[model samples]
Target: MDLSSSTVVENTNDFRATSIPTTINGLRFYHELDEWQQDNHFIRSGYVKGTNSYKSSFNSLFYIHNETGNIYSHLLPSLVIAGSLVYYLKFQLPLYESHLQVWEWINFLQFGFAATFCLAMSSIFHCIKSHSHSVARFGNQLDYFGIIILITCSLISIMVFAYHREPKFKYGFSCLFLVLGSICTFLTLDPKFSTSVYRPIRSTMFILFGLSGVVPIVSAVNTYGLEVTKRKAGLNWLIWEGVLYISGAVLYAMRVPERFSHVEQDQASLLNNPMVGKFDIWGHSHQIFHVLVVIAAFCHWKGLVQCYHTMHQDMLA
Candidate 1:
């Protein structure tokens, strides 16, 4: 049989009509016999209309079809990072008292939490919204909010590093810039740009947010000279961060080996199959992008640590 015929047969055999009583939103509805087979029963309804297996094909992690799993993957790490930062502040901040003021510490902690929240929401949007058009719309908003959160975090870092000399000024400026950047990012949430045609613009917006670090970076280099070991360390972190981000972006845009071998990658191929199980989760373009973002954040943290060490040593001297 041809591919289409095989698909029809497989779909027919995979899904059979049954009077499975289902409840959605407190309303009783007869489960349709033409439901498509998916990893997650929760996601099998709504936009997905077909006669096939509705049961999840992969592990529990793979149950939720669409990009929800992808979003969760990012979210789980974000929470861990946020929790670690909180612990650091609560227990470790005192040891670094000379380097950070109470208010500065608070600001950093708050910023970290907010960033985590945004990332979690973004992941949820990708995972659950694909079930319905309205849900997808809302998910898009959450995704944008997540981006804003990242921008807010970057702005906070910039302020922390920028006005290290003036605690009060740094606090105010950081809050102001973060709010402003968030507002701007929120405004750009036009549905038109959500399509593939606007991929470049969307990608550029994210890159712009990431690149905003250059301002504080330049300030650090100019004020604290490249001769300082701390400055060199910050530069090194920045370089590596840029490399990871750029590489991820290139992979996402190019679509790489999969694009070159479309026939080999159809559904089963690592290139096109959004749900090829664990390998796709860890190695896919979006996963790579998520990893890159985390790396960039860590690099920034390194830069901050270097700055603090250098300044502290200078003071001691």
Candidate 2:
């Protein structure tokens, strides 16, 4: 116990207990030597940080955090759908010998309608699904309306195609019927039914929208019997369209694998979230809806092509 040695030992002990600096909320914190850096791993490195700012909305395309992933998951396929329509117009439509002067215009309108419907549906789905009770309630209702609008637009596009091919038919009748159906559906979506209490009403409206296709489809098929290749192609198009539609409906209504594993899927990555991410993009219910829509559009295009071909052959005869 020499005095100088004792003094040196005390200083070394004090040094061992000195604190190290850390940061949180832009404020520096200090911890004793033993505790120093114990929580450092909890501090997120800037390199691995997730986007928290609304400014990185574009990041939704690549990142995996809540809304960003879901938003882009819906958007990418929409772009594909738009591109497919453009390809049809530029490359496919001109190949057909259509006489309708406004056929191109109608196709453009249909493309616009489909694109808008997709965007609206995506907005509604992402906006409401993760929100609070009030938000979920109101947002879900709006989402439902968006879905209805999408269905209506698709049905209208089908009728438009039919009208383009058979201008003799009264376009006004189809327009009036569509408008009336839309108004009726909107009115009948009683707020009471808006709750899960009457899911059947919501489902019925969807069915009505789908069933409306029967008018033009039957007219086209009956007028141009299966002897005509164009008629056969039209039938094939309708069949594929129906398949995509039914598959999508089943995936959506059942919620599939995600339904059984809600907790695991409630928060997911693009690699995960089978229902909303994987199946939802090109495979999801809405994507399937979009695919069916495109199939229907292509079917309409095929019918138009067949009509032009048949009419040209008839003139030659």
Candidate 3:
């Protein structure tokens, strides 16, 4: 064996060739969709569509980048919400009625699970999508399912608060959202439906899904009158939460900033610029969307708490 003359070559790109990093933890950069190939397929890069294998994605938690931010924004808060739920169960469960307690528990737990599950699915899907095309396809579908769960459960939480005032209006709106969510989940599970060719369709579907909440808002106004429900839910907070969500959704769908940005150009980038290239890894729409989504989740929590307090006082009276 000529150990002194032997050479070893790693199957990674030359680090000096570009600012993009070689395969290593905590320093991964994104690539364009066209850049994905056999040599670089396994590494966890961002700005590319689809998921990798579970083996590859399992290590994603330790990595830091736009993807990490997207995953952790939802992931970390889910943990906090979980801890809070544990406390609520231990300290506050006894305060509600023992008989109708079933409904209360359902309402309370569904909201937490919906929010947490949606986030967990998003992180997991983003992590494991690198597995293969089929895996990536399913991962996207699962993420869509999580979104549906979040929408369905959010409506349920509102129902819990206001259903008693107008049972007909509440149940009607609740069931409508549920059906819409289910259809969206079903449609998204199809691989073709999740593809880039269908990106605009997917985006529009979700935006419409969220906007459908407007119907219930009108129903709510008629049911409890404007003033009463406003006090319970904190109108300003809820409105701000919606503004955040709508803004984020619009950004995600439109593919802004990056769509018109350049890494080297410090100038104001124009629309549909061909420079929508590798520059998006730092401040892309998806990362921003997840951050806004988490904020909206917090807003939803505050509204729920305020509504619960108002209901609890009424119960006491």
Model 3 poorest ten-residue lDDT run: 7-16
Stretches of candidate 3 exceeding 4 Å from the true structure? 1-17, 23-53, 92-100, 263-279
- Residue 151's lDDT within candidate 2 is 56
User: Could you tell me which residue pairs clash in candidate 3?
Assistant: 51-129, 51-130, 52-129, 52-130, 52-131, 53-130, 53-131
Between candidates 1 and 3, the one scoring higher on TM-score is 3
Per-residue alpha-carbon lDDT of candidate 3 for residues 180-295, written as tens digits (9 for 90 to 100): 98898888877678765676787788878877876776766786788876865555567777888888888877766555543322122322234433433456677788888888
* Residue 284 in model 1: lDDT: 49
Query: How do the predictions measure up, each by TM-score?
Result: 0.66, 0.55, 0.78
- lDDT string for model 2 (142-242, tens) is 65665555555555554554444465553754675568566755664555555544444555556566666666666665776555533423446656655
- Lowest summed-lDDT stretch of 10 residues in model 2? 39-48
Q: Please tell me which predicted candidate would have the highest TM-score against the true structure.
A: 3
lDDT of 1: 0.54
- Which one wins on lDDT? 3
In candidate 2, position 270 carries an lDDT of 16
